[model samples]
Target: MPADADIRERLEAKAFELGFDQFGITEAATSEQIVAGFRKFVELKRYASMEWMAERIHQREHPQNLWPEAKSVIMLAVNYGPKDDPRLLLDKKDRANISVYARGKDYHDLVKKRLKAFARWIVPEFNCDLKVFVDTAPVPEKPLAAAAGLGWQGKHTNMVSPEFGSWVFLGAIYTDMELPADNPHRDQCGSCSACIAACPTDAFPQPYELDAARCISYLTIEHKGPIPEEFRKPMGNRIYGCDDCLAACPWNKFAQASSEAAFHARVELNAPELGDLVGLDDKSFREVFSGSPIKRIGRDRFVRNVLYAIGNSANKAYLPQVRTLLADDAEEVVDAAQWALEELS
Candidate 1:
């Protein structure tokens, strides 16, 4: 018998101990369809300003390209489901509506820590070498997770678990030891177009493709400069990320609030006021978002998002803040401030 040929139980035991919600293993192979879909996503320039996707296209083309001698990939999911429908915040014109994923401590840091712990246990127990990844790498996590039977990629192009829905965060453990692969999860998105209608910017070109340039999440977090005028109005109060598509999915009805405290929404961040977020300076922003994924955008870009929400707020109360931000040093901030001021006028 092959040594450590079957350790799914032990693997899942440790993964659950490390706070992961779901676990599955799959051979390190990307199907031709998966490879082509990713290539098309890049070829059609749907990645928008995220040039890294194109740069590492081949790395994601196959798991072995990123790590030779890899036999299997362990996929894990962390449920970050919100306690309430995140869409509830959309009509709160005076408040900032951050995505469910970013309202807490950064999942990348937390998940990577758990993945590292899991790796430390497996390398010695199973006599294998492994590398851990939590969204930072060129790994096609959604497809891989689906392949591992964790979930299907919904219309929003996010992994949707029957167990946890679209609210799960995926992580990977690529190992030299081969493990039994799980049957791929079947697509259950079916005829549901709720996620499609939920997009404020019509970011989905079709049922399963995303045009990031039109996504509010892209406008708020990924795209660094002044947001294009067209997406700004539709962005509404989403000051950090957008959760509409995820929240709109009917599969989410089965999602429970995350058991991990690290994934819980911070008190102040749950529903911060746009008036407050717009006033964040570099120092304050860092202090506020120190452990949050939001810190990556820095004050200029974050405040720019806040200003757009402020403009969409239709409240002249923020007029003074907008006027002051017009004198900000960052060209983008100044541009957003001017736009906010005009909208308020």
Candidate 2:
């Protein structure tokens, strides 16, 4: 017999047992509007240097392209809400403001572990084929989560759970099990534009669109080249990623800090000093961010980000560190060091 609504109830209970905070199910299909919006986003080159996005556009727009036999998608969310507002650290220009999500253990590792466990539990009972994914796949996780009733894509283009606000990490399990789908969540942003106004780089060209080229998170985390002159000052002390839009959501007022201990902020990364980070040679950088997502950017890119923050700090105490990195092997790091010196001058 195929899985039914009863299976969904059991699965949801099991998801909670496995440490997921929110759960929903949706058909293994993509929304046409989301597909169009994504196409337009790439067509206009809003994805910036994220060429991988263009590479997998077809698979991303239609999840079925990834696995033709999958009949349902189990969307799960883990709340990683901070105990305090993440925006507060921005004022301390000498402190590096890592994104709230990156401060904790990498969610990819945490969420994928749960996803694999859930897939294992379901496969034996239902005899259904399944595949688990975190962020590695070309999955349209946010849109799929919205389709599964986890939340609606907010104006900032991140899924905003009414319960968790904008602080959820999404993971997916694609399965052939024929489970009932939930009602899709409708956009509830109302008239609030707090998220848009809070962006330091004016990344939003419109209420629901993001020009990733100007987005601090993308620039810090994804872009490999020199910091654009226009955005360097606005980059502030954000060394890894930016959370200004997420922090400004009024819905977050009702959000609670994550119950999952794995999501709690690590002390060293919580509000690191820019001076401390600017001096990270490749060896020290690896040790400092061993298991964190920030490590993926490597020492050159990581220190490059730190140098920009150093320039923004106006602390001059960082001058010696900046001057030392001026001779670094990586051109990106050397370029950032030069920029920092000019900014300080």
Candidate 3:
């Protein structure tokens, strides 16, 4: 066998042994094809209040520009699928739904740790310097993963592994090691509009373009102020991230539940009672979600999300719970709570 072929095989085996669900390697090459579209998207101010996206527009669109020394990027995907569709709880009006991704340990920490280990192993073998990232850097992970033959970028602008759908969390190791690049995956979303249609806020302006401003995920996690009333009703029971678009993907039928114990859904997070969540004081909230991704949003934004869910509950039983938060110290939380209480009353 060729030396490079043997190295690639060894790398894949090592990745599997390290618990990464999928691995692919791609050369650090820039794609000018998508640059114009990405620029247009930014020019249209579709990034909403994410000023960082505007600031790093050029770097994000071109991977090599981020690190000129990087010769290859090893794209890794770790499955975080839940035993049940996260969207199933939407009909349970009194419950708050946390996105599958945030149900367990924070992925940023988990993925970065694993990537560091993988990099350490590779450095000795290839004598290369490695830098790792897990959504923390300007790395265009989804596009790079596609270029690496890991999967195609779905219309939702998330990587959709044919093996795991959109349930994979992406991580990358930028290395100076010269490795053979894998063939890119083809777009498998033929004649499918489920993701686009399922978005409550119509976040997708076109097949492959997403206006982050209208996305519920952005509103609940990234946007810090009051959520517009228009999108609240359609927000349904989602208290954190929205998974409707992801669940709607046809490829999900092929997805298996993730084997990583750290990615498993905590029973409490799966279908938390809106009343219970709203009743949590800052200390209790931190203690309950200590190691989970939800804690990063802090108590105020989390309570704001819970209030939106409470308003959409249509269950009068939660009115008292929503009412208690009406005088929350945080202005944003209090505003949302008052609006929810008024709507439910």
Candidate 4:
């Protein structure tokens, strides 16, 4: 085998042994087509309150601009699919639906730890400088993954692996090694608009573009203030992150349940009762979330999410539970609780 072919084979083997679901490598280069489109998207203010999207436009599009010496990027994805349909909880108005991703351990810590190990192995064998990044960095993981032949970027703006569907968590390792690049995947979305039509808030302004401010995922997890009234009712029982777009993809029928034990959903988080979640105080909340990603949102944001779920519940029995939180301190939490009480009452 040629040197490039040999390196690719070894890298694939190493990635599998390290617990990654899939791996691909690509040369560090920019696509002006993608950049131009991204620029137009930003100018339209589709990113809404996500100022960070506009702040790093240059670095996000051009990988070399992020780290000058980086010659190649190895993109890795870990699958986190669950056993049953995530949409089932939507029917139970009294139950809150947590996104499948946050139902398990935080992918940041898990993916980063594995990427660091992969980096240590790569540098010793290839003698290259490297940096690893999960979602926290400025690196454009979805675009890079598509460039590496992992999968096409679906209309929903997330990486869709042919093997793992849309349930993969992406991570990247930028290195000085000039490894052979894989062929980029072609756009496979074609005429399908399942995800586009399924969005409750119509967060997608156009195909492949998302307005995060209107997205339930951003509202419940990232936004700090009261959720706009327009989105609050549509948010339904989704307490953190929304999966309707991802779940609507027809390709998801090929998605397999994740093999990693740590990524499996904890029973407590699976269709949790709104009243039960609203009653959790800080200490109890910490204990419940413990090693899960939900803890990072902290107690206040979490209760705020639960309050939204309570309002959506339309269950008058939950009124007392929602009322109890109104006088409790955090402004965001108290505000949401008060709104929920009125809605329920």
The segments of candidate 1 whose C-alpha lies over 4 angstroms from its true place after superposition are 1-6
lDDT of 4 by residue, 167-186 (tens): 99999999988999999988
After TM-score superposition, the amount by which residue 338's alpha carbon in candidate 4 deviates from its true location, in angstroms, is: 2.4
Q: Candidates' TM-scores?
A: 0.98, 0.98, 0.97, 0.97
Error of 3 at 6 (Å): 1.7
lDDT of 4 at 192: 97
Clashing pairs in 4: none
- Two-way lDDT contest, 1 vs 4, winner: 1
lDDT per residue as tens, model 2, 33-52:
98999899999999999998
Model 3: lDDT of residue 230: 82
**Candidate 1 pairs with clashing backbones:** none
lDDT of 1 by residue, 203-287 (tens): 9999989999898888899998899999899999999889999999999889999888888899999999898888889999999
lDDT of each: 0.91, 0.91, 0.87, 0.88
**How many residue-pair clashes does candidate 4 contain?**
0
Q: Which ten-residue region of model 2 has the weakest summed lDDT?
A: 1-10
Candidate 1 — number of clashing residue pairs?
Answer: 0
